[model samples]
Target: MNETIQTILNRRSIRAYESRQIDEHELQEILLAGEYAPTAMGQQPWHFTVLQNPDLIEKLQTLCKASFLNSDNASLREIATREDFQVFYNAPTLVIISGNSKAIAPLQDCVLSMANMLLAATSLGIGSCWVHSPMMVYGSADGAASLSNIGIDFPKGYEPYAAAVFGYSAQPLPKAGPRNSDTVTMIR
Candidate 1:
């Protein structure tokens, strides 16, 4: 199989990671991959925030857990209360993809960038996982406040649309799970 195809196929959502940080060069390359992702209408309105600060990561995790615990949803609260729960799986790096909330197509653009970053990480022997929970915190008023606490500022009228944690895996990669064939349809 082609290397690109193989990378896509082999990509997995890694949850556990070693404390070791990914090399700065590799992180830059991954961000470059995200920057090169195709955008709709050529609107490259996305913003990438690469966070490597352990203290900031821990603060964000604390905020996320507090937000989850205060949720109206019981399941989220329960999970947040779990002794072993971690918002970013203790990964050494957090890459947040955000864009103008008022844009006509911000989410799609941000997600594509996220996909590119994931594939790039996989190709570089790094592990990654798409994390949606942070969006909840980012969208909330309190959560938005915490952004400034970490010295991260979104472009005016922009907010985090997606995020992922990247680092060296602490365990072996799991085998790819079965795909849902029924979801596809032949139109031709």
Candidate 2:
């Protein structure tokens, strides 16, 4: 079996992160992998905003908190409050995926791209968490304006699709859950 394939199967999401930052070269490669993910209609309309500055990352987290507090969506806001209203998990790096809304496909396309980056980071001995909550801000006045304040801009229809935090693990990660047979099928 190919090593890359093995890495893919072995990777898992890591929640707790060390304070150390990732190497620049590794970060670049991870983003490069995201850029290479297949996009619908070959329209690679997504932009990746990599966050390395600690101060800036904190600001983004603050904005995320404010957005969650102001979200009209009841279920999400209730759950966020239960989680202590924290966002971004204080990881050393954040990658925000945004896309052109001229078409709706960009939303899913950008998500797949971010997913690729997450696996890539995990394979590189790093930890990653896919954050879907902050994305809600992209669709609102407070969140949209907040994103712009953090140097993330939209080209009219462009909006955030997803955000992920990555870094070295602070503790050992749990083994991946069993690949339950029910989730797979073989086509004759």
Candidate 3:
């Protein structure tokens, strides 16, 4: 298989990471990949928030944990109750993708962007995990307000649709899980 296909197959959702931050140049390349993702009507109505500060990342994690604890989902509450739970898995960098509310397909556009970023990160030997808890926390009005109070502000009319953490993997790359062959259908 070609390199792109190989990378796609090799990419996995990393859950553990090292303390060192990824290089600036590599991060820019990943962000560029996200920027190039296909957008609906070429609107490209997406904003990327890169959080590298340790304090801010911790604060956001705390907020997300609180949200989970208060959630009605028992699984979420159980996870939040763990004392060592870190929402971003202690990755040195967190990227939050947001989309303009007026865009034709904001959520889809943002998700595509996230997928590009994840692939890019994997290609660069960086570990990445798609984090959904942040969206769970920041999707609400109160959560947005709390984020604003902490100086993490999104562009006006833009709402977070996806988030992920990137860093050097502390553990060995995991093997790909077995795939089910029955999921696909032939249309032609």
Instruction: Name the candidate that leads on TM-score.
Output: 3
Per-prediction RMSD in angstroms? 1.3, 2.5, 0.9
**Model 1: clashing residue pairs?**
none
lDDT of 2 by residue, 1-188 (tens): 89888888767777778888999999999999999998888889898888888888777777766677787878667765775555666689988888887865988899889988988897888888888766866666866777788876766777888888999988687798877678868899
**Which candidate number would show the highest lDDT if scored against the true structure?**
3
Per-candidate Cα lDDT values, in order, are 0.90, 0.81, 0.94
lDDT of each residue in 63-150, candidate 3, tens digit only: 9988998898999999999988888999999999989989999999999999999999999999999999878988654999989877
lDDT of 3 at 41: 93
lDDT of candidate 3 at residue 10, scale 0 to 100:
91
| Lowest-sum lDDT 10-residue window in model 2 | 79-88
Higher-TM-score candidate of 1 and 2: 1
What does the lDDT come to for candidate 2?
0.81
User: TM-scores of the models, in the given order?
Assistant: 0.95, 0.84, 0.97
Expressed as tens digits, the lDDT of each residue in 1-188 for candidate 1 is 99999999999999999999999999999999998988878888898988899998888888788789878899999999889989899999999998987777899999999999999999999999998877888866678888678677778888899899999998789899999878978899
Worst 10 residues of 1 by lDDT: 139-148
Model 2 ranges off by over 4 Å: 72-85, 178-181, 184-187
